[model samples]
Target: MRSRLHSPTVRLRRLAAELRRHREANGWSVSETAGRLGWRSPKVSKIENGESRRLSADDLDKLLNLYGVEERGEREALHRLAKEATVQGWWANYRDAFGSRALPDFETEASAIRTYEALVVPGLLQTPEYAEAVFKGAGLTDDAVSIRRLVQARMERQHILFRPPAPHLWAVIDEAALRRVIGGREVMRDQLQHLVNMAGHHNVDLQVLPFSSGSHPALSGDFTLLEFQDPLDQSIVYVDTASDVRFLEKPDEIERYSLIFGRLQGHALSAAESPVYIRDIMAGLESDDRE
Candidate 1:
């Protein structure tokens, strides 16, 4: 399990949540649990909160024992999860390119992804050249190696599209994103073409939220809603900011984002008409080139 290429971020979080629930169920406070286990309060807090960078199977065993989880099946299942939690995804090597395992980890287990981008193309749909321009433009780093690694990491995240039972991806991109020529005309052209091609995939739904639609929801910034296949896993909103990655998991927050995405989908072009909209933009770019 540790040898697997993908990070078990979801599994780790699930285990943490489960441990926290068990502890709370027994009426043991964090400090009480730590005192019983002869560990620091922060140590217990970190592991229970899924903030631990590395979790030991031994520690998990101790936790299971403390929580009075006796059933063989239940204990074994959790033990297996704890073991998988130690495994790191391929992106672990490119920490500079991508900070923290948050996004990649959530993406690993997401069964459906809803994205709304106002300023630029979604990373999954971006061409290599376009990705390079985005990375440089964002001022991530001037170093060539870091930029290359970042682009490669972004490209690798698209593999989920081809995986068996590919996750359903519905992307609502602003009209401005389609019109903006990033990395010059050739790059923008290729990027738009790729989006058109990807739209045809059975699991992919692409929409263009035209400028003519006027103002609507999601003016704050870009965000992604990740839904998991498992009922135990909670759906989450990933807010991507210039400085930090924020995750919203509260019931109200999830409902709010879900409604916003639905509204965006309603206002955007239909799946069938999106390609037409894109082709028109492509032609406009061509006319500018000719002039």
Candidate 2:
């Protein structure tokens, strides 16, 4: 997870998004760009959309020339940005791991995040000790120093959830997660208490699905729908399995995730009552701990 957040290649995607804006404003079709570049239309579309893995400086020069960028300084900056873009797909190496890469980008631009978590409190809601304990339980073994560093990174990531320009976060947790002692009794109690504390914030809306809700949509794995303020920009779906993390794009797939989130939200406790519901779970956990 720490490895995923330290990537620099992700910066280039921001540059790519900028170039796309200029192309749209100029009303250049993919075929027109293809004609100017002496390449196929698909190539132009892929680079403009930040989907090109082997982007080159020469290709960037040709594309910018087609856009009639007369200023030398502006052109140079874009050239450097393109050169930097050639770096490895920041998230590529970790493609088989978790989807931590998407969170930074999402934190930068997402206006709202609707998450359906089936088995635990979201990472953003984890206490430092809870994060450390959960990582250990997940088999993230390390000496004292490595464990501290990893936990610190996870803690830093949580700042995005409470930053000044924070996005609206709607997290739906299942009852089973509330019941599970992820990091033993004490850590689980701390984690649940943290959830109750975060629920006090207006920007954060936390809801829990009780057992009685039974057999609703989203019995599947965990997923999150990230919506941006710019409607022209497409939304993203973050899906996590125990082994792999997938960032999805297809419109229909995103819609399915969104629809499922809507249904789960209905089954969850209301915003005002969510803390109350979770506190009850915490009390139950505390009682069991005493026994």
TM-score for every candidate vs. truth? 0.90, 0.77
Query: Which prediction has the highest TM-score against the true structure?
Result: 1
Which parts of model 2 have CA positions greater than 4 angstroms off? 1-32, 39-43, 52-102, 140-144
Candidate 2 on 60-107: residue-level lDDT in tens? Answer: 777677787789998887776666555443334333232445455454
Clashing pairs in 1: 7-89
Model 1 collision count: 1
Clashing pairs in 2: none
Pick out the ten consecutive residues of candidate 2 with the lowest summed lDDT: 1-10
Q: What is the alpha-carbon lDDT of model 1 when measured against the actual structure? A: 0.87
| Alpha-carbon deviation at 214 in model 1, angstroms | 0.6
TM-score of 1: 0.90
lDDT (Cα, 0-100) at 279 in candidate 1: 98
For this target, which candidate reaches the highest lDDT against the unseen true structure?
1
